[model samples]
Target: MSGQRKNPQARDRTIGAQLKALRQEQTTLNLEAAARAIGWSTATLSRIENGKRHITSEDVAMVLTTYGVPMAQREELIESARTGVQAGWWSRPLPGVLPDVGTLASYEASARAITDWSFSFIPGLLQTERYAAGLMSEDGAEPLEVTMRWRARLQRQRVLPTIDYTAFLHESALQQPFGGVDALREQLSHLVQASTRGLGVRIVRGRVPHRLLLHPWLLLDFPDAPPVLNVELNGSSVFLHDDEVRSYDNMRSMLDGMALSSAESRSMIGQLRERL
Candidate 1:
């Protein structure tokens, strides 16, 4: 643990999941019962299980001892909890930017794959600087905050090459010139070039039934932990985990069946750029 580095947030997530599994499988106690046995409040235990609270090696030992887990398994989990924490840029968030942006970046940093389903705008990872600034301006962001947010966005986009990235975008999003016609054309051109790289640029054609689509959401899958679904709202966001992520998985499957292939999407984008 001395020489190795780890993201504390991701470490907590994997540790928490493993502990939750241990509790359910090795013991008959429910969450409430387990908390009582460990002399911890239910809320604290629940937060630990959900990876919303910081946990220490001692905390892992206490829970495992209370559950009568075998010493070998207990040692393994405690060792994992002992890993050193490394702070990321998200630790000190950019002033005036939405706080949830940091949390989203943290998750993105640890994701093995990411799927973005958007209906009204280009996904942030796929947006150009001008296009992103235009969006911030339209939403009434102050000029300074807009600059800070896009700088943060540029940092987040660095993970695109490291993970399996895909964006399922509706045709209408391409038609809206948020940053004016020239910027829009440049954005479309960027998308075309991105498809030539490894990015998955699947286009969801317009006029599809409304029931088949939903508001924008990002699903991030981890190598060891459960998948997380991030649904953005006005000035805030919600992260869904475990069973709650199933619906989004189904939605992704549907989109996969309907979206145009990368080649087709590239051609469509080129055609749209020409029409512009």
Candidate 2:
């Protein structure tokens, strides 16, 4: 092993993106020129800038200094890089769960805005413990793994209060009670109260049709970096950046056009909860 990390973690990606953005805005030099200023090969710099390789806080300092960023400005970014590399709970391995799970959590934590589009089930961020547990159990995860996964999920949800968060859920999602009737009822009640807690939960009435509504995805917008699109699969996730994120961006706008207002969604959820 070269002792270099691949599939760069979220912190590394964020740091790299910030540096790339700074390079673009703060300097006229091209990538090759900028890399030369830092004594790095163009290819090495490109990989770091595009988040394909791991980077250190020291690397961030060097890049920013090369770009002539003010010391005050550089300090905050350097600190962010320092703290970001520290391992969180998601750093540990969980059997039956992929590393992207942790990566997704890291992205969510750093995002300034988060939008979740769900079709077949409730988004994990808004799921109740029992509800989440039921889905995990149904997926054939071991009981211990279910416990670990939900705990990590709950931790990820902590970021909601700190960011602009919205969940666009299909009417079909409200219909499926993963954790049984009573659990689903509580989950719906939770959704009704979500807005009060600063979460936007919009219901996309199932009758409305769109090709982009085929699967679930989370769009994470960063303060200094490009938006990342996270699509969770069976036990893995696919992250899209740059041009690949365009369709999902359009999908969000489409949902905004068609989904019910927050008040209407609360009422709908309340009604559903009553019947249950």
TM-score (all chains, Cα) for each model: 0.86, 0.84
Lowest lDDT block of 10, candidate 1: 1-10
**Per-model root-mean-square deviation over C-alphas:** 4.1, 3.3
lDDT value, residue 75 of candidate 2:
100
Error of 2 at 42 (Å): 5.0
Model 2 C-alpha lDDT per residue in residues 49-136, reported as the tens digit of each score: 8776778778788888899999999999999877877567666656655678878887787789999999878999999999999888
TM-score of 1: 0.86
Clash-forming residue pairs, model 1: none
Backbone-clash count (model 1): 0
lDDT on C-alpha atoms for all candidate structures: 0.85, 0.84
lDDT of 1: 0.85
In candidate 1, stretches whose alpha carbon ends up further than 4 angstroms from where it belongs are: 1-8, 24-29, 54-58, 61-84, 211-213
